[model samples]
Target: MADRIISGRTHDAYMTVRDHIADGWAASVCTVPKDAPKGEELIKLDTVFEREDVAWKSVERFARAELNNLK
Candidate 1:
């Protein structure tokens, strides 16, 4: 699957899904600072998931909630 990005005015949420070498799937969520240059800002890993669907849904929900909180 392709990476998903949720952009906000001052921040963006970057969602990445990948296949785990051991087994299952892995998903990660990172917050990007819009003001910083690419690769300059710190990216924090939120969580990992065993299922693709669950990871997608969780990231979407997290992005939405973060956007709402910013408002």
Candidate 2:
């Protein structure tokens, strides 16, 4: 997967994608303040998918929606 960092006016979405032993792929989307430390973030979404493309799509969709909501 590629490195993706989605940013909003004051917040940013950081996505982590990894392989799942039981499932095919796992995706975690976290939102944090633009200038805050790494630990200062919230896990906005956590999902598992059967395909890498689908997992990435879901991550992008959720990240974009969260960023848009901040607008």
Candidate 3:
């Protein structure tokens, strides 16, 4: 199966999405704290963003969860 990651704005939302997906798949969510250091890696919500960029961000988050053993 094609691997994928899905996310949301909050932990509750993230769990909701995770529950909605198929069985046997893992989920990870990225949460950039409000106090995150100012850097290019931090996603800025000051304006709209590229759709693909957001998609990749979620993928990154999911990978992090796996690396951190959240999955």
Candidate 4:
């Protein structure tokens, strides 16, 4: 099946994967404090959900849940 999602740092490789998907996909990242200092051209982990704990797992899960809604 064609990959419909790309979850990782919004770097060159990540952006490339999203660009290749015909149906497009969601991208995500995990970071302490918060995501990238300056937003790029895709999803921002911190913006996906709001919580006191900025754990990687929490942000990851929240991002996945949001992507699942696209299905």
Residue-pair clashes per candidate = 0, 0, 0, 0
Residue range 1-71, candidate 1, lDDT tens digits: 78788888778777777877676677766666766544653444556677878878977887767755665
- What's model 2's overall lDDT? 0.86
Compared with the true structure, what per-residue lDDT tens digits does model 4 show for residues 1-71?
22223343332211111222343332344222224332343534423223223333454465555444444
Candidates in order, TM-scores: namely 0.69, 0.88, 0.28, 0.30
Error of 3 at 28 (Å): 12
What is candidate 3's TM-score against the reference?
0.28
lDDT of each: 0.71, 0.86, 0.34, 0.35
Could you give candidate 2's per-residue lDDT for residues 1-71 as a string of tens digits? 54478889988898878888887898989888887876877889888999888999999899999999987
Ranking by TM-score: 2, 1, 4, 3
User: Could you arrange the candidates by lDDT from highest to lowest?
Assistant: 2, 1, 4, 3
Cα lDDT of candidate 3 equals: 0.34
* Candidate 3: tens digits of C-alpha lDDT, residues 1-71: 23343333321112111222433233333343333432322322122223444544655654456434422
By the TM-score metric, which is better: model 1 or model 3?
A: 1
TM-score of decoy 2: 0.88
Tell me how far the alpha carbon of residue 9 in candidate 2 is from the true structure, in angstroms, after superposition: 1.1
Lowest-sum lDDT 10-residue window in model 1: 37-46
Superposing every Cα of model 1 onto the true structure, what RMSD results?
2.3
CA shift of 28, model 1, Å: 0.8
